[model samples]
Target: MTTYICDDPVDRRAGLDAATAAAARGELVVMPTDTVYGIGADAFNSAAVRALLAAKGRGPDMPVPVLVGSWNTIDGLVVSVPPVARKLIEAFWPGGLSLVVEHAPSLSWDLGDAKGTVMLRMPLHPVALDLLRAVGPMAVSSANRSGQPPALTSSDATAQLGDQVSVYLDGGTAPIGIASTVLDVTGPVPRVLRQGAVALDALREVAGEVIGAGQPDGA
Candidate 1:
């Protein structure tokens, strides 16, 4: 595993360069995000996406989320963004919210078995954002085995992923130990699919009358 300590300016530059190289090689990379460490591969590269799924032992039916550098990158991926969705994006993007929307038909890449929906998020971490900006859209999911706890630190990610991933960007621990809250906005009403870093009440503030995923605590 190629590891770099991101505490220093020189190391940070090297780390980003390493991550860029890994992505260009179509190799899976584990890097820290605001919420959790994510395993990433080039989103537009079919072979890279497949390799990421295989590395994680993820099945073809489970689709991974894509992490973009900024909100501008989202428009080309999703077919349409509802007013409420746009509000949420404006309010909480680059933070800890992931929105699942209808994918644009023009998008040619396949992420396992994503059906027609694609989850998009712009993480708030500088290293993650820089890497995404350099590498473009990346097929990213929590760096952990499927059905297992998400990795909160670079050590956790390395333990779970090992050599299966080409490089592990040790950007220290993540700010949020849990995954980002997932919201589905493809329908008329915005719904919470999973509650994590972002709270239900917070989502309702922007979405107004958000429904939880059949859970008692969902807002």
Candidate 2:
């Protein structure tokens, strides 16, 4: 178990290298994101993903989300990007917005109980972006035990996760210190599954008429 202080350029580069190597080995890593710290694994590694779930004491019923380095990464993951999804991505990607879309049937990895859909996001943190760009898509979830408040700092993550995570990239406290707004885009209209950093009003501005999960379609 290693924790790298990433405020130093030298330490940051080294931490990224260690994290990339760890993911390649199918090991779990804790890294910073725009909203909070996340524990991540190589998205293609089922065993690693399972380990990530175990580390958090979470069940498959709550599937992990995937974090991408770029906007274009989502094209290959989902069956097809809806026009509204593109609009949302254009407006709030690299920030705090997660879209749940139907993943391509041909893909091999498993995130558990997601049914046929996957939640994807592109975080706006430099350390996270650099690591994701190097490691490809990662199965990431909030870095804390299930039902606990999300970790806003690497130390908070470490306190909960301990040696379960192979690499801990301490990128200081999370900038937003809140969870991302999660939206399900598989429906005819975008629906807000969980509201967080991004407001529903802002989502409406970009996609027009967004609905909460409780509301009926077209409401």
Candidate 3:
């Protein structure tokens, strides 16, 4: 396994190229995003997604969220993005705020226990955006073992994933140290599964019924 330092321009460009190629081959890459370091694989490759789960010591019951390059890509993956969801996307996307929407039934990709829904986000980091654009959609999760704190830097991610990953792109420390706020738009209520970067008030402005804090499950 090779670890590329993303400090220099030449090295950053080279690392992006190598990482993109590695992902296309269904191999894992540890790279930085706006919020945290992520371990990612080609979303369309079921075997690759399974490998990612193994690397994290995670079970098949937990679904990994996806990272996309644009809004059109978002529409392509989900069965439908309701107007309220679209409003949330417009307000906080390219930043945080992940939306759990109904997955398109015709698509053949398997992302663990997503069932009929998938969590999707478009990060604001340049390295993440570049990778997503080059490799299409990716099934990405916090680059750490299950139950561990999210990795803030690529080095932190590498320490956990180790040689299991093909390449580690060191893009320095992440901008946001928390996970994205996850909103479930698939259920009857638009609810916050996990809250971190985006607040519930912002979500409530667009969504008629935004359930979060004070709720039994999460916020």
**Candidate closest to the true structure, highest lDDT:** 2
lDDT of each: 0.88, 0.95, 0.89
Score candidate 1 by TM-score against the native. 0.95
- lDDT (tens digit, per residue) of candidate 3 on 73-153: 998987788887898888887988899999899988989877899999999988889889999999999999999989999
Once fitted onto the true fold, the runs of candidate 1 whose alpha carbons sit more than 4 angstroms away are 215-219
lDDT of 2 by residue, 76-173 (tens): 99999999999999999989999999999999999999999999999999999999999999999999999898999999999999999999999999
Better candidate number, 2 or 3, judged by TM-score:
2
lDDT: which is higher, 1 or 2?
2
Candidates, ranked, TM-score: 2, 1, 3
User: Which is the better candidate, 2 or 3, if ranked by lDDT?
Assistant: 2
Candidate 3 Cα misplacement greater than 4 A, ranges: 213-219
Question: Can you give the lDDT of residue 18 in candidate 2?
Answer: 98
Badly placed stretches (over 4 Å) of model 2 are none
Error in Å for residue 82 of model 1:
1.2
TM-score of each: 0.95, 0.98, 0.95
Q: Where is model 1 poorest over a 10-residue stretch in terms of lDDT?
A: 210-219
Ten contiguous residues with the weakest lDDT in model 2 = 209-218
